[model samples]
Target: MKRHDALIRVAEYDRFRRPTSIRIDVTAGCPIPVVRTIFGAPDKPTETVVNVSLVTESHPTLDPTRKYKDRCRLARRIADRLGIDEGCHVRVDAGPYATYYRVYEIREHDAPLVVHEEHLDRLGIDGEQTVRLSTTIPQETPEQVRERGGLAETLVDDQTCEGVLVTAPHGGAVERGTDAIASRTYDRLDDGGVRASLWLLQGYNPPEGSAVTAHRRWHVGGFDRAVDGYPGLATLTGRAFDLVVGVHRSGYEWIEVGGRIDASVRERVADELRTRAGREVRTDLDRLHLPGTNPRISTNFLSKGGDRGLHVECTPGTCDRHVEEAAAALAETIRRVLA
Candidate 1:
């Protein structure tokens, strides 16, 4: 696509942020009546003393008459006018802060753009800020979805030992405590002089009373883990890793262990979980239909060609209570297996 640019006064356009209640990543919205009255076209200005509420800060869509897709349509229109491709990245420069975002669907619209609140916060725009929106077609576009930017991540590539990778694709509030367990395992491994690459995906949801759960908003399945934009998963799959351990959560009373690995090694890991972590371990995952056996799954995908990986699914209680023991057990077993 040809390069396009727009020197638009953001916040001047009918901008709205993603509210806690809104499930989708809505960046732009239609201009409200008050905005039209004061800023654009209206016989008499209606909004004299507008009250900006904290609740509204979370949700700035004054006129939420537009549906979820409609909001995206507005942003896409802005992108199109700027000559950006449908799936290409748009480099948005709001003063000092700059971010690259992949655009969603595109349709024609002349309405002013309403920036999403998250983008505003990231760009450090308070109110009525001017931003330079530019587009470029990079040689190698990152394999990421529209909501990829919404999810937070941490990637460690400098320290890689034994070609081992630790991952928590469903981290933060999505899978509750999976991120913590994965983090503990990574830290324990690092402290023990076995530095490994790590990738953690965390949700940015509020603490309590959220209308939508993190899993609903940002959960990327095992098969899609490596395909998604996170660098750690890609690194694991790209290299010849001897072992790849994925931490996850389940609702069952006992922890479940399943992955593409040697039968003896799987049994050993289960036994260690039972003895060291003092938690019940289930090895009959094939019967449960969650064997994690597919080579395309992140656990197996990250491991060496033969699917030499470990997938550990811990219960909520196990994650909270026995994470340290579980991490130690995993590290010890992994060190031995690698050796």
Candidate 2:
């Protein structure tokens, strides 16, 4: 959508449900051991404020808007999103204020600054041009997230025929950490036809400088080599591949399908999602690709595929608990479509 054509806003939400205040912040680089979001006030009744404790090893910036834009570059690359932010407004009737704490790690200044979210008030930019998902996402602590799964070695299929690529970018501990099942799902795909993979085994933000090639190509770092101006994924795209399936974990209450490919491909993947209900497909022109205020944002590989692709988002609650089983089932469905 054009900048002036239609603007996405918080007011679009039902009057009672809209977020009264919006925040956009960028935290210090990761290996960031602690991130505490203080929700309720000391009394736990009045909505006093929301706080973020980011432990980085560098100087925090005063320009939160620029910091926010830079911080989300990798996310836009990982998820290929083009919105102001993905926020969840916790309930609080009192003064809603925010604090961002950035304690740069003692030694690791190289770690990239990971930006979280930016909204109407945070940017001071026009809301119409931005797309924001106002979700009350549960801020799960690392321990809570680790409860689902652990990190695994980044692995890719031996076959480089470039037919189908199955990926789990946020498998280990990305934004919405999954059990690394996105990568684990590789073991289930029929190796004969698909080029399966389990990359981004580490937390999201495209593990930069961690690329290793003991056997198959292992670009554990963020999208690399840049294809068609987009980074994070280069080799995987640029081919007339059949399908590129990105199995991501959704933090929202429902499952969602993103990317703008052919209608059939989108619908087929949506049909394959193993959700009981609550599914949405976001194909708006700007939304289809991860378009942010910054130039770094671009179309994600799911829609950047040779002939369009499937960006499958899994809702853990509705999906089968047995991740391997659910993943394999979804893989099989994708293979069927390729056939």
TM-score of each: 0.56, 0.42
Instruction: After superposing candidate 1 on the true structure, give the runs of residues whose Cα lies further than 4 Å from its correct spot.
Output: 1-150, 159-162, 207-209, 222-228
Worst 10 residues of 1 by lDDT: 1-10
Q: For model 2, how does the per-residue alpha-carbon lDDT over 212-321 read when each residue is reduced to its tens digit? A: 21111111222322221111133334444455556655545555565444666555555655442334544333443331112121224433333355555566553435
Residue range 37-127, candidate 1, lDDT tens digits: 1123223222211111111122344223322211112244454445334444343444433333444344464232444444333333466
lDDT of 2 at 238: 42
Q: Report model 1's TM-score to 2 decimal places.
A: 0.56
- Superposed on all Cα atoms, model 2 deviates from the true structure by an RMSD in Å of 19.9
Deviating ranges (above 4 Å) for candidate 2: 1-153, 175-179, 191-195, 204-240, 274-306, 318-322
Cα error, candidate 2, residue 11 (Å) = 52
